[model samples]
Target: MAPPTRACKYGLDCIRNNPAHFAKFTHPAKLVATRAAASSLSTSKKLKNQKPILTSTPNTDAPPSLSASDDNRDFDAEVVAATHPTTASIVALVSTAVAPDVLANISGVTPIRVLADGDKIAISSYTIKRTHDHYYCTCPAWSINNRPVDARTCKHLKLVFGDAYEAARLLWKDPFGNAPPAPAIANKPKRKKQEDKASEDEDEENDANTKKASSTKAKKSKKNSDSSSSASSSEDDDEGTAATKYSAKNRAKREETKLKMPALLLAQKFEPTKTDPTGWWISEKLDGVRAFWDHERQEFVSRLGNLFTAPDWFKEAMPKNISLDGELFGGRGKFSETVSVVKTNNSPHWRKIEYQIFDSPSMASQPFEDRIAKLNALYPSKAASFLSSQSSLPSSSSSTATKNSHIKIVVHEKCKNLQHVLALLKTVESKGGEGLMLREPQSHYIGKRSNTLLKVKSFYDAEAIVIGHEKGKGKNSTVTGSLKCQMASGKEFKIGTGLSDALRIKPPKIGAIVTYRFQELTNDGVPRFPSFVCERIDANKPSDAVVCILKKD
Candidate 1:
């Protein structure tokens, strides 16, 4: 079907009102009904025998040549002649309405419903309307463009239909192969205005292209473009075509190839009955940023896939072929400092940070013990035994250089039984270590959290959803007092302690899930002395209730 023009209403309404004269334009169902009604009104033979007469016939009753006095026609006669549309005139109007240029625009555009976010607690959505071949959108962009009733379209229309508005208009063709010849334009000013608008659109497009090219050049120079800069920048630009909340520079930086997340196994909460630490390899759960080294890319990435820009010199000692999964640690309780060092593009602070290798996601199919053994062989520790055992192999660097490598292999000690596990946990706790990680000796590494690994800690901790914020008082009057949180069981509590001054000024959002540590449960089952740990971005609102578990000392 051809797109309806601005004058479509007059032509279509004329055909609808006088259907017998223009039944071919009506729908098949409506046509069938009209034919049946026509047959019932009179026999078919009577209609065939009758001569076909045009609805619009020139008036012959008046004088063939009108004088000046005759040309002053009666007002009522002029009105009646203008109001009624003749059959021949209506056919001509329909032919013009479904012109090749107009029909082409109709086929390309498509309306779609979209949900647009409104206020803080509200949502607004509307449908794009296409009625009688005219398109309109309920979006603000359409309204701001003055709700054009003609062929003019807004950004929303282009986005919803497609970004082929200019092409569609230029490439329009007659669908029925019977398009009428385009009408001649005698109005020069109107034609000139259209030409000027086309010129302006072309100028705008050229300006936009120039701006984008300049921006690309500036961004390339700003970052000291590497060999990969051109390829990465172009890819970033292509991806940036989609709307994003972050800035262009930030979005480009974010798109840079970071370390693929290591699908290494994660630990579940320790359950005494279902879990037995007998013969299991145990190691202290280092409190640091979880880092994965991409041997291929020579870059470290966080669990969430953010690039950890370590100094070139720092990563130089790492093995080129083998990817390592570990913690980028600055000793115990230095997580924030380590994060700051690793997060920076280039910093001397990374020298103090160490990559403690534990597992490899690439060799995740191997059992826990075998995977650890392979990791040890690829990047041997500083121990003399490692040096003597693999001394025959050609070294990438000098033995002295290997000995001075900053990376450490976490020693996984096997526990005799549950008693030994407890004893090791106590010793580590006394030394202010974070916690213990117990791995199932025979279990193969998997990507998800499972019972094959478990975390045992001294203090009880649980995740809660942040519900609201309590304003601070006195010295802390300008900042937040505490975070009001709710447990899965619907219990609400206020966590005021252990929140840093920075966090107090801008606390976690209301629906954020955060971890909190506490000593023990109260008689009423509330966590006693609950302190803010950190936001659990990896976790959702936990299914179980947040109640403290009492561990035997």
Candidate 2:
């Protein structure tokens, strides 16, 4: 067969003969159309060597980069010249020309596919992933630049909705707009007119109102001062005899009441027996400060109220008309820090402390279940909602009454017997906790043990100074018996245990300081039956050896 003609004999030709036809192929719009038409063909051979032809076009203001390219310089200049005059206008034009569907398919992950019919195009919903503020398309043509465009516009985005990306740039306008225009000045001469008497009357009325308001405010201030003075006078009068009486009554009541302290009580590690079994309750010993909340004052009072300044938030959460015995906890393992915070005159951390109430003194007269029921009602929603709506309110209040509504009190489940309780105590101790509380379900709420509440803790040591000696009693009347010592915190107590017979015979010198091991704190600021730990030889004065009372103030 003869060599194929340059123009194929079959009429179908790879190269066009007319220069005009080839020039049309160079136009961006025409090139895109031709590419689309060629893409529909099944045979790749027919499209070989079909380079985009170019047409000459004058480039008066062509970009330097475009002129550098010889083959498509005219085409590039033409496209650049065709762009809208203003950058913003060009962006808007590009934004509108880009097809949404092409943008969707830019990334196969979440293609912004579009179906277009002339003027109308439907956009398919898709999510685009942005990396480093640039959009990447999985589409084949994206690799031409080896990265997404600096404008973050993708070819798929351009093909779908035509130039929407550019429009988005224009839409990102400064919220405040441009600086406001300078105010215009008036140059006209003033006109003379008779002044209205009503204006003067209005001014006088406004001045009178101002004077009246000032007078009213001053009078209210004076009234408040008078009321404050009267209240102070009354407080002063009550500070003497009445105050003492009140304090005595309160102390007596508190002493008579059974308060649960968070301190662990140490017990002898003895085996259990059928008749005399060791009793215990398993409870997560909350690492919180022991606080006695006095509902009457709407304030949380520590074991020693004078020591800490309770935050207003805590006071706000406190239930009115109900005294709660609970732990003022601030999460876990922050006991020393929590104590330090509560002891400060005014601490921001005090707000973090929460009262994990375990007992209610107001319910002392009721059964354990009933008291708990009342507590549950006062608790915020998450803790408990078991108690009846009426029982939830503070005692003696109407069922519809709302008071101290934000306080939350959680009641733990009761143990079956002493064995179960002891297991809980062990668990608490093993976890570096204070102890467990045992409440008799059937017993009434009382201040003292009264067979209602019991505390279990581990043995811990405290240092004290020898204060005095107690004369012997009964069979050993000849020798001094109890050695009275004061803790370094200024707490006085006797250490009658852990003393050798010889030490008992002739206790450490009167001025000598020593350490005492105690389990928990007693209500009267004394250690719960302390025992001698060791002698301290470095102390100066015996009184200085006493345990210093750690106060919040």
Candidate 3:
């Protein structure tokens, strides 16, 4: 059989306007048109005679227009009138006939319950019934203008048109034989002004918060100034002589003197045991920068005496009128960087550093607990209204007034035993740290240890009192000599490693105690694998020191 033509599949309209193409076909054009018309007429007659089939299977190929509840009867009428102007009435008739069944199927309801006589339908739950002349559904979609539901051209109307409406359109052909143009729709209004108004409101709220914060800061600064003035007035008579000695000229000269504060004394050995040693109070060593706050100066000074100017918020949290010895840290693992930043004057990086105050060094004569009580009282949990207040102006003009205010101070807890101390130290080191510091709970914060403070670090080393020197070997042989020293334990050890060129030229003098990094002890109680670190000018030999010698038994 010959291939079916496009006209045969689409219908007579496909070739209605193309006379040139129709002329080439063997069959006469009029005969083809007659056949198509006869077929369509027969199909229409058969559809009219047959009853509607209610099948379980759904029609998946059909595109969903509007929802089943929508009643756009008028829209459907307008669409049909626009698309098939001549056959609009027939189209409407077909639409009304098929819509009820299609709408029922789409809505998952049975048409038998919804359909009534004389082109009427009842939406039972809403108590609304519809007819061609006066249709209505209680559904909100059909109430846009309170028109008859059938005139709304909702989803119900679209479903009613179905294949019958399309079939009718296929039967009729326009002389132009072209598809109809789409209807125009009105544009919606914009909401730019409302959006702009909302944005402006948000900006106003932010501005209010900023103003409140500034005002609070200002009040705090004013309060601190009043307190500092009162404190100075009370001490004026008693401190007259001392104040004269530290007058403007003298103070300026003293500031020029670069007095290096003592470095932390690190422990040489660690004994991991269950029991605590006698007279030793264990405490956790915080991983932070070594800091010394000079209360007399009314400034937070680092170990290097570089003043750390903090924000009013932070300053308002620090303890007033007491020097504190502690660490300024930004968590762990940032020690070297923190130290470098603190050493510099006016560096903004110090803002990230927190001062973990462990001792009130200026109150050395007072009991440890007493000092802590004073520090705690200075920085209360709930700040005073003055301290909590904000400033309306910038920080530069606000500095003098905010002086001598409290800052945040973290105190290290004293552990119960050596094991707890060791555990804390191990935790810090395991997470990449330096070591732990132990402070006696009952002891005062003395300038010197006074046997009250001890540092605990990994890697054992001894601070040996230098007795003499031995000639250096290999590359350092021609320079100075090797260090022959006696430990506080009185044991003798030769530090062969860690000798620099300068150290070799001028070895530590006799009677000078120097630090030696070493490993385990030998059989004869002598230090094994000793290496030179640095000389300890501030250390002294114990009275019961003995000579330790390593001998092969």
Please report the candidate that would top TM-score against the real structure: 1
Q: Which ten residues in a row have the lowest lDDT in candidate 2?
A: 206-215
Q: Any runs in candidate 1 off by more than 4 Å, and if so which? A: 1-260, 382-404, 460-482, 485-516, 519-553
Clashes of each: 0, 59, 33
Scored by Cα lDDT, where does model 3 land?
0.41
lDDT of each: 0.50, 0.41, 0.41
State TM-scores per candidate.
0.40, 0.34, 0.33
**Higher-TM-score candidate of 2 and 3:** 2
Compared with the true structure, model 1 gives a TM-score of 0.40
lDDT of 2 by residue, 11-122 (tens): 2112222322333333333232322222211111233653222222332442222223233112232333333122232223223443243322232222112222221212
Give the candidates in order of TM-score, highest first: 1, 2, 3
- The worst-scoring run of ten residues by lDDT in candidate 1 lies at 190-199
lDDT for 142 (candidate 2)? 27
